[model samples]
Target: MSAPPAPLSELPLASRQDGSHPRPQLIRSTWADLDGTWSFRHDDADTGLAAGWCAGLPAAQEIIVPFPPESVASGIAEPGFHRVVWYARTVSADDVATAGRSEHAPVVLLHFGAVDYRARVWIDGRFVGEHEGGHTPFTFDVTALVADGADHVLVVRAEDDPHDLTQPRGKQDWHEDAHAIWYRRTTGIWQTVWLEAVPATSIAHLRWLPAGPAAVDLSVRLRGRPAAGARLRVALRFDERDEDLGTIDVDVPATATSVDVTVPIARQRNGQAEDELTWSPERPRLVDATVSLLDADGGVTDAVSSYLGVRTVGVARGAFLLNGRPYDVRSVLNQGFWPDSHLAAPSRGALRREVELIKDLGFTACRIHQKIEDPRFLYWSDRLGLLLWGETPGAYEFSATAVQRLTREWMDAVDRDASHPSLVTWVPFNESWGIQHVADDPAQQAYSRALTDLTRALDPTRPVVSNDGWEQQNSDIITVHDYEGDGAVLARTYADEAARDRLLSGMGPAGRRILVDGAEDRGQPVMLTEFGGIAFQPGTRRADGWGYTAATDAEDWIARITALYDAVRASTFLAGSCYTQLTDTMQETNGLLTAGREPKAPIEQIRKAVRGRP
Candidate 1:
């Protein structure tokens, strides 16, 4: 197979030796990034484990960490599929010591941003842990395994079978070549891998739920068991200032692993009016906070910095509400694929740039299509105030294994991203890829309902879309996809009261029912989640690049897109619309920007089109 194309553009933060911490919400002062080059080899026979390769692999070539082997940025641009791959790196004593080593001994945690399909880790020839999901952060505590003042070898085995329909592969092309909507396959590590040092009794996870304009609910989960007299202290402050909003102290029972505490926010603090601190796209407001575990003697055992946005999302009266007001969601579909990096962004700046560019184009939200995006992307969205729909990458065929794999991965993704305030919805399925018989088969329908229920159970604060585009089962919102190129037809189909009623009552676009049997709309908010895939390739059409309707020229492309937006706006039923993408990917040229993120039309014009303004 030919190697993927090299990156057309480089961000300032893109480097082989990136040392930045991966997770921004939960910040630890002492951590080391292990994102540089690492010893790597493909284990085709899967005999590396028997050969004692975990201790050290002989004749292993160097490959860049974080970037997948399929991508050009990984240095080893071997695009062929290998079910298993091995990666090894050495961590020095100093690397662990820099993380606030104490006489009591610190807990060293090895974190992987993501590893495709499944991953197993070993430190100093001792097995640590394994993770199944490919799009969520997983960690292994190796404090007991690695001795201080010594060099330790870290070995990882990542196994993936993209062609296996049982696995949740998302947009990773299962075939040998990219076809239809699927692109190049991403195998092994595709995100940041790093190490963090923390106190033995540190805060493991946090969930920030904005109660209202006046209060925020904070949930804390502890990593290790604390002492009998240990207490959790939380202090909240505005990100823009050092003034304290409020503070809460919660006593934890020795057996308690988690605590939920509500902290009140004063409208006026220190003679300053702070009532306008609500988070929104116009003015993104973040409240910085610190969680500390204090012992009986008032000695701080552990502290971590985190930020939260005070915003609530709800759907009511056929409208999506943000902060209890009707908020129109102007969004674009982001597939989260780069021409060079595949599923991985070249840098954190690249992720920020993507969000910034989308926001600059007058979009209020991004529907991260199929792929569960990097946490850094969600971080930028939370910091910059862009609404997000956290979507699950779909599996093609339904099976017991597919259900298990998707359930495990979907829950992991929801848990990992539910803390972000910008995440407005959890989409577990898209267009019925895995459960193709969802509309007719009772088993598929039950599975769909189960996924929706699971998502709600995991994150009740956000809406759950069981199947985003069509073949809807039980969903909080009624969403559909239609690529009717004509604006008048779209308006007639979705805008006209009589036509819309018929569509909602029976079949929607593509002769699929808008609601499943025994399911009622119940005034749920409606969104045109996917539409307007106007393709514009400036020059020659590459073999793998195409779109729904090819634009004759730039002006024609702009006119078509603007018209589609106009139709969407004219539709009184649509609470929101997601334009068919942010950027082009292999075999898909229907993006406003090319695969390299070059604008096809004027930014202002695109903004006008997106915002439904002439």
Candidate 2:
């Protein structure tokens, strides 16, 4: 069903929504892409500020927005370490102006999807705002800066310390050259930068929590204060099935910044119909909803479009359940790196293709290791029906400063991405990263538990894994990583119930205890979160490449992986298993597919092994 025409004031600034739009989860009709060529230069000596180059730069080379300087896609593909970089872009009044809304003044909001380490922005030599996180997004209200029709030169100074281990730098190498498990750095703006106009009063944030298959709770935060007798209208429909589920209208309390409303599914339907409305990897159903703020006169003051996916994710009876049904998770570890672009995907299509590729491998889920992935990737994951365990990058050291930085950024990420239906769990740390002394140190253990508790507090819908794949406490799932290539030996550990119990009690895979001492095991589902990293080169493996194990041929690779998967499936104690990786990353060649995303072996056979089928 085609959407009713949006108000002229809400005319679309872009043509498509397949990933070009940065914030796909919550979209407004007014926005523009600032993702092409931009004036850029390297600040090797950090002299840009002292030299007063914010207004403009001298002989600045061109680089692509949303692609970091270290990437080939960016015009300047300098490989060596560069600590600081700058980006300059021009935005016109039209870029930030909503069509046909002249009476009620609109505010132009400049948005950055992400930038590395730290970013300080200046508009026409005037300092605007600064943000510190590299993976999540930040926005600045630039209405005053660009209210005049004259063009505004937006300057951004991005500072990333290549050697800063205390920061949450995920898999980005500090070394000049990319090496084992670490890829090149992403400096400066690495995600779509855009502008949009909204009423002075608009929706600041929107969060959806499924109350069940039949209802959802909406946490709506207003950008500006509302007058008395204001009302919120929510309309839900499934565009794919042309099904209009229902609508809800609620009154907003005066002078309130945040409000909560519960919406029930409108039409009562049969079991099959309700099931059809429910989301799963097989169906991937999504209900599009438009939320409008109506004033006392019943005119729309502001409106935003979002989607809802009704499904339940939890652990019960020692099994992972989707919609309360047992779900055997076939998942892969995703680093989300491209050969040409490193951390930045080559294009919007690449993000969608990544999700498609994971689904193509017969895997139902992915654990985005180390990195807080791009929002566009999360958008595709939501639309395409692949489960995700959202993780933040870990800082190498534990300090009060590190704690503050990580906690702030992690909360921002949780606030930004929790609405995604595919994000089924929160994993704060991995293998005792940042909290290296978690095994023994009380302070470190508290830090880990604090993150888990904090994440649960922010978004309580999903489970939390304080630390994955090692010395874990207060984790919802007991996850262990073992590269035991011998399927028989691996099977004896995970497949045997007594061995599984013993392993959970104290003994862990690879000499890393699954649960730290004094942490009770609440009969949580056990998963071999990482295994079967068999690197196969088809003809010859790279001499410098690394994997948990090596395979000489397609036959050998398939047999080993199949045996390992069968071993994991052999256990009644096991809820799921995740393959070590989806694609080869940098110097690591354990991927089922190469870094270029080509299957090393026959795709069908690999799928069979992943699914444990004939």
Please provide TM-scores, in order, for all candidate models, with all chains considered together.
Answer: 0.94, 0.96
**What tens digits encode model 2's per-residue C-alpha lDDT throughout 138-241?**
98988788887788899999999988888888788888888877888888888888887767788878888988767888989998888888889988777786
RMSD of each: 6.7, 2.8
Tell me, by TM-score, which candidate is best. Answer: 2
Per-residue lDDT of 569 in model 1: 85
How accurate locally, in lDDT, is each candidate? 0.82, 0.84
Q: How many residue pairs clash in each candidate?
A: 0, 0
Supply the TM-score for candidate 1.
0.94
Model 1 lDDT at residue 54: 84
Q: How many backbone clashes does candidate 2 have?
A: 0
Model 2, residue 72: C-alpha shift (Å): 0.8
